[model samples]
Target: MGTSYWRGELWLGPDYGLVQGQLGHTTAHAHYAHQLIIAVGSPVTVELDGVRHSGHCLLIPALQRHAMVQAPDPAFSLYAEPLRIAASDLQRCVEGVEASLPKLQAALEQCPRQPIADPRVERALQALDATLEGKVAATQLAAEAHVSLSQLERLFSRDVGLSVRRLVLWRRLRLAMALVLQGQSMTQAAHGAGFADSAHCSRTLKALFGVSAGQALKTLNPRLLA
Candidate 1:
């Protein structure tokens, strides 16, 4: 069988994003965004920390490593903002993904964690998101968040499921993915996304997402950005 996947729809924003598609063989990798996926027709399976999870619907939290293969069938998956996805929202959001794209978007946008949210961490994350190039100092970010460096680190780990260092690189890779779609060379995309070089970008992508940047582009197509 030919091993290319066609994306159905892609919705991306600073806070949350979702993409759905048919899938082929995929390497194991972990990402910063919490993920939810459902099979459109046949069942999908994901390998988690140890056991294999196979089902019609499931959600995987941020930073928890997993690898997925779509069983040569139709599939869809949603990546939610880790901090925004509440325990209560998982079922509803997964349902929303299957129901309608708009509903999925709306479900993703609901601010359930608004009151309990910390603005410092939010600002820090925003800073990380905008960091398309170069390293931003943790001290500078801590100052921006009005917290001590230690406090900021703790908050990031608690809320984002990653340290500030990891999140920064995660944002860079994400930016690189977009730049790749715009026809930038992998080397160009790497430099633009703040990596040392294309080799560094390739290694990071393979380590974190279990595929090279080129392989990812071949595996899935982005049908929509917003």
Candidate 2:
């Protein structure tokens, strides 16, 4: 990957939570999940699929290749959880939300309630969350959820917006960012977050977000963005 060439802040939200970015400049990249932007500093513009959308809020479905450009001003993104989307009435409430810190915080908090309508899918998600520290086979996950492997796949694809493996990688990458924020060196972050090496983490981050680990590492600020 090339130099990041952008200036902004990116931080891991709470564990097993959102990856939030205070967006400025952008390069093209495909993320692993559904993305939602609530424009704060400027009207958010997204180039998704073939068309461009500019709105106070824009929702990009998972695995859809897109780029966000706002230049001098910044917007905020919540890599929205599918279970949250399923449970919350974000569409109805986000439009009415004032683009400010306090209001946005309250609105976001109300959006995702757990133990969602489908117990099986919710159980699968909880199982996956519990297994993030170690590898869990797909079949094993299915059995733990009391569902077939194929059912697990469909549930993830349909609800969470990404495959199970991709979500696991996403979690690992977020954990890496969190470790870095806690002042771990890149090598330590990689090892603790389950990457083979710092280089492996860098490559994975670049592929997933078009930003280098070194460049993004500068953006971590625990007091402000965490």
Candidate 3:
């Protein structure tokens, strides 16, 4: 295994994001969005549901347990929300040997601008986005969406590809990661992101990205791009 130093730049959009820079191995984890990882300098190996896959570019479906078993010095990871961009569209943009970061960014820019048709689901998602600190509950989101708890849950699964709880946690994790990258202490980041404590945040970090908060803070000096 190589050093765990992963310096990178993160560009965030409304429904998509891109991370480009040095990357290392990741522990087994899963995400709520479709991910396309393009290796730099050399081929990379990924462990998907315990199966090993090696390629210069790999696409992991939403919610599939996987890990980067091996990666080169630099890599480009693109995360696209399932609702905003179809998997085939994303794949086609990065296909063959000419794939690059600019191409992926262009792909994101080309995504359909149309909003979700379901007003309730959109309202619920807006509520979650408004509360990135994890301060809101499902019941509150349901209320915001003007739906029952069961209906909200059903709508989330149908439209968001995740449960309300998972979406909340994912949003918090993103906030916590950004805080950590910005030089906050684990405890501070944890609290700032609405985690109960540093321990809970650490556990969630490892579970989600297969890295500890300390390691991420120390190693992943991600520059947030405008």
Candidate 4:
């Protein structure tokens, strides 16, 4: 069967800004700041100040230095207003946020923790980590894990908190943004990232990032490219 399509969305408050978008093999550099990150995809390993987390999402506050290495596939993220809530208070705030963010929250609610012994999720993650531009199928992923599609879905949902389809779309968007950042032409980036065409890429980018690809490209740096 064909790969399923999953929709990933992020809502950022006024204080937050998008820092960088680069290919999976590319490394991004940004000053660490306090913020919350909502992962709208499968489990990803994120490194912050030399510490790492493999989970569905995280709520990191200010002064907590961080960086990320998204899975080989595309990943989705959102930056929220920083708050000073203790773990208990943070949980309450998450509850409130989830109530308001039904779709994202639902995806989070379904995520499962990674297993320590079985490394299938780890292997699948490696495959996605290897490339920033490409297509991946759930069936193939399941086959690699030596499980059926249904079993893969259950394991993913149980351990990562989201579905495979959502993870793929998120990864695609991430790659598209990366290509645009690297000075790739919109058409090139669109097709390279697996969109139907430039128009399709523009529509999806605007819908997700709240700006047209052209606008996003222009903002990539202070000096505009010709």
Q: Highest TM-score among the candidates is held by which one?
A: 3
Q: Tell me the tens digit of each residue's lDDT in model 3 across 96-119.
A: 535465677776687654468799
Q: What TM-score would every model get versus the actual structure? A: 0.80, 0.74, 0.84, 0.46
Q: After superposition, how far is residue 50 of candidate 1 from its true place, in Å?
A: 1.3
Q: How many backbone clashes does candidate 4 have?
A: 10
lDDT of each: 0.70, 0.65, 0.77, 0.49
- Residue pairs with colliding backbones in model 4 are 34-62, 72-128, 72-129, 73-128, 74-171, 75-171, 111-161, 112-158, 112-159, 112-161
lDDT of 2 at 197: 88
lDDT of 4 by residue, 1-226 (tens): 1112222233322223322222121122222223344444455565656677767556555335444555434444433222212323333444434423444344333333224345776566556545435667787788777778898788767655457775565556656656665668878987788777889777765554434554445533421111
Give me the runs in candidate 3 sitting further than 4 Å from their true place: 95-103, 181-185
In model 4, how large is the Cα lDDT of residue 82?
27
Lowest lDDT 10-residue stretch of candidate 4: 23-32
Which sequence of candidate numbers ranks them by lDDT, best first? Answer: 3, 1, 2, 4
- Candidate 4: list runs displaced more than 4 Å: 1-118, 129-134, 222-226
Candidate 2 Cα outliers beyond 4 Å, as residue runs: 1-12, 15-22, 38-44, 86-88, 112-114, 223-226
Which candidate number has the best lDDT? 3
TM-score of 3: 0.84
Instruction: State model 2's lDDT.
Output: 0.65
For candidate 4, the TM-score is 0.46
Comparison by lDDT, 1 against 4, better one = 1
Candidate 1 residue-wise lDDT at 148:
96
Q: Write the per-residue lDDT of candidate 2 for residues 71-144, one digit (tens) a residue.
A: 23555665554455532354554557765545655665667554456777778777776776567577878888
